[model samples]
Target: MRSSMTLFSTRTLPLISAALFAFSFSASAQATVVDLGVANGYSAFIFGNIGSSGSSGFTSVGGSIAAGGNIYLDNYNVGTNKKPGSAVNSMVAGGNLNTGWGTLSGSAVYGVSNPNATLTAPQWFPTNNISKGNASTLDFAGAKQQLTTLSGDVAKLQSNGTVISQYGNMTLVGNVNADVNIFNIDASNLHNLTLDLSSLKSTASIIINGTATNITMSGGFDNFASFANRTLFNFANATTTSLQNVGINGSILAPNAAFSGSGDMNGTLIANSVSSINYGHVAMNGSGFNTVNVSAVPEPGTYAMLLAGLGVLAFMRRRTPARAPQAAMA
Candidate 1:
């Protein structure tokens, strides 16, 4: 009968290529997506070993931590207040920013506004305290805005514009480093990451973690201090977002909620190091030390070969035998 069905379709095409190579080697061992995005437009800069202790008022001018979206600036202490156009420093935070896109965990989530984030936009979003106003031009791209709708359909949206920054005055830890950015594509799961900076002249610490997942944090954005981010943690979202310099090792757990997805990487976003992160809380430029946690790289095993490629695809479909004889015997 047609040469025995052409010899059973050449032995079921080599058992369907060994069940798609054991389901692609168990999906490369599950959990794959750590690029922390970066490349096109380019961004990522880290420099540690910050000393010069502070307190009486604040001054540790040895910070150095940057990532970029375009690396805007309202203040970098250029001449004395990042001159040029002006927006030099101003904050009064707000909240609500969990639009789309997901997967982000490159760790760097310090602390600030935790007094229940009151006094309206207290510092500089989600949590990190702020409030260096008077300029009223600072804009971290409106913290990567996203409300959209306002005209009906989806009902009542509004927001509609912004890439990152709004209000202003932010510089996580200064003297220098604090220029974040995030927007790499291939779109897997990760949306906004508009971390604007330039004003911590008072207090603004943020040291989050990596190995990201569903996250959406937009804590009240004003800028000042309260001591928040020392608790709320959870990294594991197809990880990777490192500039290397893991201060504050494992067990990072503060950041109760945040999420966004649809990731790509063609945009590049490669520097790698999104793993170690502990509860937040730092004052650095404002004073508050204790940092540890160097470079670490683990999680290799390929998810047990993707669950052993599902029993090798059910033993190659039971050795592929019947195709029609009673529909393969039901």
Candidate 2:
């Protein structure tokens, strides 16, 4: 009896305690995740430069802009769609800000002192929206690392939605009840696709991971703007990603891809470089890529602990002797 009690205390109890603790911790703890770190606030977060496509001289942005390289602009208007109380700088250039003429609704910061000699500087609207600073405002190098990691991480998620290809068109349908709806598509098959998100909940996030070397999103993705705030398009393996004519709804996460387009991108634009772009609008839905955790899965070690605890209880039960029957006399 003493031996059994000792076993229960020394081995079984600890195992059971550990198992319960691990399981409880795993069940209660949840990781709160955000898509982009500091880059989320920008209309365009480019690792390289932001230049005009030579076709359109008027480039407008609804939010703040950040670039690792130079910002070459002929006629740029920024911070048009920003919140009235937003105090952040409208432009943060890691290299230089070369502009012939433009108006910034907010302050500007640049790394290089000298802009293009042809233009003195970009005009600041409201007169009070002028704040000049050096290049230490934003960490572009750090943003590059985080953006690359996000691209790869989002791609690893298993697809929960179906990508149906029929009649030379692709259709994406998602489960409305699901917290996250993931879709995987190749650049080859994503032509004239329609976003059937009528069933999806407004708060649920949608992740579209595209695999290709060179990807062009044009004509497809009708009505993507309505769900753009809750959507993220991750092009992890692309070297070049271009948008043409159509209005882009979601944020583009292409860390290695050179982003160019004559279209209007309405969400957070993260890429290696952006050139010849037309419009970069801040996420319209307000909450860009909102993700919520509905359930939690225990870790491998936690499962092992639980199993071990149950096994010990079973072993102890088998080892213990049964109590003999006693007769009562009247």
Candidate 3:
């Protein structure tokens, strides 16, 4: 009886351990999805801190603009003023605004000017629900921390006429002569990866082919484009990102760095701050890619089921009869 009981315990323990491990892993993976919180409202552009110097441009933002810091729009247009369709979106600022010579044609501008004042504030100035100096709705700190937890591979390519480097289910294809570095990542095979090009020249064009995967890029690119929508370019580890007259296409997730350049970008921009001289455009995606939805951990019922299963296995082991004592060995 004792021998049989021991055998049962040994076999069942391994199975129970495996089951527990699988369940935990699944839960952790599901939890990686992060919620963008209030940042989701402004699809076009969102920034946490805008320096006192501010920005100036005539570019158009397709969606809304939400700023957690002071907005210095000295000489810029915030909406469309074309011939037939002369319309503007909403602009919400959490801090003060130094509206020098800029013109806002949006439906409303919140957190700026007093509602009852007679001064000729921008159209729809001091809209309702305008909160000033309030905390940002987006969880900047949480998002940065989440990026650190992501794991992936790193691929480096040397541009010598035609550079080709493959690493861990990802391929880099580009012509060094044309100064183009393209990354073709297999999203299904490799979920997380980073392209380190800090050592390469900044004149190279960087392109990414995967969407909705964990990917990060270090160093600067003269031109950047993405074929996949909802692709996130995390620059959280870098202190600053400089785009010198380069136009990029993709969402930038830089919670800690400041973006400074005289270039233009088409896609959502979530960063600590932004400073631009020329036309800098950040167009938000309406496909719900700018925001994330993090799922909660597995429910208590899941844990209960695992415990119950282990308990039943133990009970069965006790009930099983031990093999009869074998005859004395020769």
Candidate 4:
């Protein structure tokens, strides 16, 4: 019902504030610094999709960031859809896992930037296998760029004041000072999220089907440093689709960044700094909230099961006790 992330802050300045209104919604800001206080007005505004879908049964993609101590938001999609040769016809629907280990379904549509953009099955419907669709298969054909996933670990000593950290993945395209660590988790100093190619960034349409993998984006000995995985950057004209799990170690910077995803985050999330979650809109019937708890470490039951199985096999092989040596008979 709840997620593991925490509250965040945003700000903007005077001149920077004016510029935010000038941005074109065709894509994200080219410059990593989303100056919300600047006065740079938009010549080509692109934020036409921002507002709660009133029974439209679909969440409109949107985004925002802080600059010069001001928050700036103007909806924008992505650079390229992950689904290659697929359709970009925007659709809607839902119901998914809370731990983020499943596929999503319903009417997930897509749109692309140019005819060259390709769409793939994994990119279009990542939760396809571990999950299902409500109406039909996922159709992310038109998406220029889609937020795949935002996960990592704190690269420094995080505290209650800051709820962000350095997250290394396909989304790390710019020089973003992610200092929004809000999760108040106290545990082993590190963050390890099961990763794979699809979990990373994508330059072209990439299909990711449970290519179960592991990657250590970053971590440290700091208490909250393990949970300081908040705030991300999406530079202007940037694409890390070919992004794989990498390492991270950095600090929080002003003018934090923002990113949007095609992944179903269709749910409401609540956190007290322990953990955070991301999923689709939470309907009474639809599944929502993929939790990430920093306090409780999952038991290594898999390892235990494997060891127990091995012991059973060994016992069966040696059904009788060892016989004593008969050297004295000679």
Candidate 5:
């Protein structure tokens, strides 16, 4: 009986271990949703760090500005002053700033209120009434992690006449002549991808496979206005992504990536670091732009797997008999 019990223990232990392993893997593989928190209050600009060379450009940001690093606005105009909904928005910075001839219209500026902090424009929110650190209140790290997870999650990929090319660590999915937009990408499992939209009218929805990958966009997007309501770009797996002279239509989710661009983006920009140079402008979507609402519900498949594992463990425990008590002789 003792030998039989030992064998049973050994067999059951391995089965339990396997079940636990599967359960853990399923839980970890479950998708993660990022919460922007108060950072979403700003509709225009959000960045982990921002630096710029002094240049005069007619760049306009339609939403609020939140920065983890110092903001250097060199001859730039932020926020509309006349629009009824456009009350001077909020500007929250984790660090100090030197507004060099740039104007920001908002209720007030929040964050580190150093005495030496220069503010050329009038502030509705007094310096003495500074709020908490904007960067600390935000979960940039979690967002980046979500992106990394997304990179590991690939749904499906359909290619046309395009040839997948590799440039060092980067992967290019389309070419100039090929109608690269013919490829349908189900981002549910897409890891890292660099899509060339040099000759495409529209692109399919890209579900993010959150991973620590990088994505880049080259060329222009003419049909962006059509899909402005849908999510056009999702780089939840990328650490860094760049946009060069493209007109973006949908929401872009790159919570971990440092997004730098010189084009006009018409959507939500969520990232660890965001910067723009050479007349780059961000125009938020009126309906679903810069709202800090994220629901991280586990996928149905994940829930099913988890439940099945638990059920197996319960059955195994039921099958195992309890040790019987031995009677002592007087």
Candidate 6:
């Protein structure tokens, strides 16, 4: 007679292994948690050019900068406002790099040849840390696809906050105890509307989705520094985003928009192109997205294999005959 313990051991071992394999495969399928990939290290990740012309306003970046097109900086500063003792790549451009008077506290990398690129009166930390032919290492093309997918996924999330409008001011209120909160607002009402986010908790992940193809925001957000790291403003369908005179706190995700803004932003900025970003003295900080939820799903083939294994185990258990007792021997 086959012992019950032997049957259980043989059947349960394979099931456990199959279950674990499926779980691991699903966990690595798609990431729900927001990840910027290669662009996470940069404060400003632009798919197109940086400055419109050579006479653009002075700009200061708190972290690294990566641009797909040419980078024209009249008076600029990079890798200065970051962590105290960290010196990474200050500037990375896929096109030419034209600078008049600026300071790069780290290395500089440009794609074009010497004639198309110029670096004049720029003070380097390690004394002229300039290089060429490393633009492909930044991988701006991969970042664009990743950010676009992220924007779409985040926009599809369910809204969990309330939007109240009164006297040209909009207030977004969410539960403090929730892990993730989403809010949707129209792009038309964004201009000149004061945003109130004082009721939101600092530890929670906040996502603000816009509903327009062209967005122009000119308002200010209150109590933004508290939840800046875990907050994201997703402009998924925007073709052009104009942020004028607004002190933005959360990270801006506009993968397909031409971003033209004035004033200072305190988070990561991702855009398709930059006509001009007049930051004056104040610039974008490295307050990037630091937290979010991640969902895991198994592939169809792995799921099917697990189901077949279970079915075979059940059939074997059912087909097994019981052992007969011999009482005449006693």
Backbone clashes, candidate 3: 0
lDDT of 5 by residue, 7-103 (tens): 8667876777687687767655653333333333444434455544353222555555656555656655556432333323345555555455555
RMSD after CA superposition, every candidate: 20.6, 5.1, 11.7, 25.8, 10.3, 6.7
- Distance (Å) between predicted and true CA of 257, model 2? 1.6
TM-score (C-alpha) between model 5 and the true structure: 0.51
TM agreement with the true structure for every prediction: 0.23, 0.75, 0.51, 0.18, 0.51, 0.72
Over 4 Å off, model 4: 1-299, 320-330
Query: By the lDDT metric, which is better: model 3 or model 6?
Result: 6
lDDT of each: 0.24, 0.69, 0.45, 0.22, 0.49, 0.71
Worst 10 residues of 6 by lDDT: 112-121
TM-score of 2: 0.75
Deviation in angstroms for 270 in model 1? 22
Best by lDDT: 6
lDDT of 1 at 20: 59
Q: Rank the candidates by lDDT, best first.
A: 6, 2, 5, 3, 1, 4
- Return whichever of 1 and 2 wins on lDDT: 2
Q: In model 2, how large is the Cα lDDT of residue 324? A: 67
Q: Positional deviation of 277 in candidate 6, in angstroms? A: 7.5
- Local lDDT at 320 for model 5: 70
Off by over 4 Å in 2: 1-32, 52-58, 84-87, 112-132, 277-330
